[model samples]
Target: MLTIEQATYDAIVAHAKRDHPDEACGIVAGPEGSDRPERFVEMVNAAGSPTFYEFDSTDLLHLYQEMDRADEEPVVIYHSHTATEAYPSRTDIGLAMEPNAHYVLVSTREHGNNDGPVEFRSYRIVEGEVTEEPVSVVDAFPR
Candidate 1:
């Protein structure tokens, strides 16, 4: 299961809604080896396609370097799908490189940009295998 704060979840959904029609991608970083998602880092979708999402190579490199220096790791990697369900595509499964990170997919097909329901789901993609997971939104993480 992926447990996250409500504010973090809302921020991700907002970013996805803001970038509707084009996939929104980002990451939530936490302390190294920590599964808790504490920091939201919205990213540019290099692909800029409704059906696809790719982090900008330059931005990804810099982000990784910064994370390393800060002793942080990406606990959640997320993207939005404009027209599809909140599920990973074949390409997404093929590109799963973070076995330890939660892969989140948010679908804005039902509501587009207006105020309506969206499909927000989490998954674990490891070595081309996809496993859907449960999500729990809380007010905050315990100290």
Candidate 2:
């Protein structure tokens, strides 16, 4: 299961909604080896396609360097799907390089910028295999 704070979840949903029609992509970084997602880092979708999402290479490189300097690792990698369900596509599965990161997919098909519920789901994609996971949203992580 993927446990997340409500604010983090809301931020991700908002980003997805804001980038509707063009997939939004981002990552939440936390201390290396820590599964907790504590920092939100919205990214540019280089593909900028309704059906596909890709992190800009330059931005990705910079993010990696920054994370390294901060002793952080991406705990959650997320993207939005404008017209499909919150499931990983073949390409997405193929691009799963972070075996330890939670892959999140948010679908804005139902509402499409309207004030309606969206499909937010999480998964584990490792070695081309996709496994859907449960998500638990909490006000905050207990101290």
Candidate 3:
């Protein structure tokens, strides 16, 4: 399972909508835990299209430094699909670098005016297979 904060979730959604007509990508930062994972957004980049995602290495380096300073290793890499479901594409399957790291995809389809079902989903890309995982986002304040 993967746990993400509500603010981070909103950020991802916003990024997705903002970059609609193209794909949006970013890094998910937080301390990894068995449950109640504390995750947040580190950066956002615009991917060219459904076929390719361009991650700025400099941005990644910056995120790495920040994570290192916070003693938090990157546990997830997230992106969005503007016209499809929250599932890994062929390119995504081919580019799965960290098998253990969580892969999150936000589907912006049907999300006109930013008022669509929160299509936040998690997966693990291992050996070309994208395995779905459970995910939850914590509110800003505990209920």
- Estimate the TM-score of every prediction: 0.98, 0.97, 0.80
The TM-score that candidate 1 achieves is: 0.98
Tens digits of per-residue lDDT for model 1, 39-123: 9999999998898999999999999999999999999999999998999999999988999999999999999988988899999
Tens-digit lDDT string for candidate 2 (30-131): 889879999999999998889898899999999999999999999999999999999999999999999999999999999987798999999999899899
Regions more than 4 Å wrong, model 2: none
| Candidate 1 segments whose C-alpha is farther than 4 A from its true place | none
Worst 10 residues of 2 by lDDT: 47-56
At residue 72, what lDDT does model 1 achieve? 97
By lDDT, the candidates rank as 1, 2, 3
The Cα RMSD of model 3 versus the native structure comes to 2.8
In terms of lDDT, model 3 sits at 0.74
Q: Which candidate achieves the best lDDT against the true structure? A: 1
Q: Which stretches of candidate 3 lie over 4 Å from their true place?
A: 32-39, 42-47, 112-114, 140-143
Q: Give the TM-score of candidate 2.
A: 0.97
lDDT of the candidates, in the order given: 0.95, 0.94, 0.74
TM-score of 3: 0.80
